[model samples]
Target: MKALAGDLGIETAVSFPGRLTTDELSSLLGTAWINLHFSVAEGWCLSVMEAAAAGVPTVAYEVPGISESVVPGTSGLLAKDGDIGDLTNRVTEILHSPQHWWASSRRVVESRGWDRVAEDWERYLTVVFSSA
Candidate 1:
């Protein structure tokens, strides 16, 4: 990945701070412009819902479990599965179109009540990660 970035003359400034705390993740979500989910498969992704809760729109593939979280034009943009070109276009569209981004963020925020979801998430995470 680093080699490709360097070869393409791309200044990859982002760093992977391993294992973020809840506070750090929350802080990131608050400032994030958009959430990008490239997971090949997920079971009702919490990250997607979390992004909606923070008023951050999402760009992801149109897959089963993920589709439940992202409401296409309403909550976020979705690309065709395994299509990088489509994913790039979706991300670009969300970034360039401010009104769409605003509408998505507003709709996501208006439609979801995250209080109960958050509690469920904590419990789910605990159980899921305990044996990981």
Candidate 2:
């Protein structure tokens, strides 16, 4: 992770296994942090969802599952799925361009709250109950 971070010109602080618990990870992510999870592919990745819930914008590769998870320019920016140059450029943009990055952060704040998600669920449940 450090190497990947360095290649992207971002400094990374890693906690060895057992060094950080879930609360610590949450706290670390709760700060002014930009989370990156550039997996080649994923299936309903919780990290991306959790980061959005924590109000942290993300940078990820443009792939099928990831695409479903992150809305580019809103929750995060997408780079070429397997191209290092594109990844570097996107990461650099997030690191150096505060406005674009914060736009994503604000997007998260605008629509990713628990209240918003719960409301969606409530609506679904209401329809289901009424139909039943």
Residue-level lDDT tens digits of model 2 in 1-132: 667767777654553345677898778677755778869979866788677766666788888888878877777778888888988777777777655665566566558667889999999999999999
For residues 17-43, what per-residue lDDT tens digits would candidate 1 score against the true structure?
Answer: 568888998787787788889987888
Candidate 2: 10-residue stretch with minimal lDDT: 10-19
Q: What is the C-alpha local distance difference test score of each model?
A: 0.80, 0.74
Residue pairs with clashing backbones, model 1: none
TM-score of candidate 1 on Cα atoms, chains taken together: 0.70
Which has the greatest lDDT? 1
TM-score of each: 0.70, 0.69
Model 2 superposed RMSD (Cα): 4.1
